[model samples]
Target: MFTDPIADYLTRIRNASRAGHRVVEVPASNLKKEITKILFDQGYILSYKFEDDQAQGSIKIALKYDKMTKEPVIRKIQRISKPGLRKYSGSEELPRVLNGLGIAIVSTSHGVMTSKQAKKEKVGGEVLCYVY
Candidate 1:
């Protein structure tokens, strides 16, 4: 069993995008909310809203697409650090996605952030996922 909620979150979005769904919903958690925020901030997603229903809360995400091209903004998303094989990196060893064109979301001591932000903050932790 994977038991990786983060990976589940990413796969849900990926499946929805492939199905051309405008909105996708996932069971909510603080970590998922932070990741959604990062995706929104990086322009990979259009918007997101968190619905609180106690332990049954969820997140609604608006997937982004190019207006003129009708192509998804996020071309690829991959879970880099699995629960079985964790990947950790220091600030200097952070992965550069697509030669800086894409972003690697990292869970740092400071917080979950894009690799660029991590580099700027001079910290690093788990390399969570890659988005391009």
Candidate 2:
């Protein structure tokens, strides 16, 4: 059984990219879906879709690649919150990944959003992950 699905999700994508896989499948959950959406919106990933199954569903992600360099768009992905230690932050204390070059996914009261959006909306939440 997976103790941390978010970490698993990120690891799956990371491994797939390292192996030069175009796509990777992960066990689905609402949080995972939200994270996937955030990644797509930030242009780190190409696309994703959820498939229904008898048990929990599955998510298929189309990894992104550069046209000229043929390199993975996302160079790194890090999970902040975990089952043991839950990290939270306010809008003012929100992190700027790579001096704003990367994206930090935050789970706010308004819902899951990027640190930039959370800051704009003046909300604080648990720091989910940082992506570059």
lDDT for each of the candidates?
0.93, 0.93
Tens-digit lDDT track of model 2 for 1-132: 888888898999999998889999999999889999999999998999899973988999999999999999989988898889999998899999999999999999899999999999999999999999
TM-scores for all candidates: the values are 0.96, 0.96
After the best TM-score superposition of candidate 1, give how far the Cα of residue 4 lies from its true spot, in angstroms.
Answer: 1.2
List residue ranges in candidate 2 displaced over 4 A: none
lDDT of 1 by residue, 7-81 (tens): 999999999998889999998988899999999999999999999976769999999998998888999999999
RMSD to truth, every model = 1.3, 0.9
How does model 1 fare in lDDT?
A: 0.93
CA displacement after TM-score superposition, residue 53 of candidate 1 (Å): 2.4
How far is 15's C-alpha from truth in model 2 (Å)?
0.8
Backbone Cα, N, C clashes tallied per candidate:
0, 0
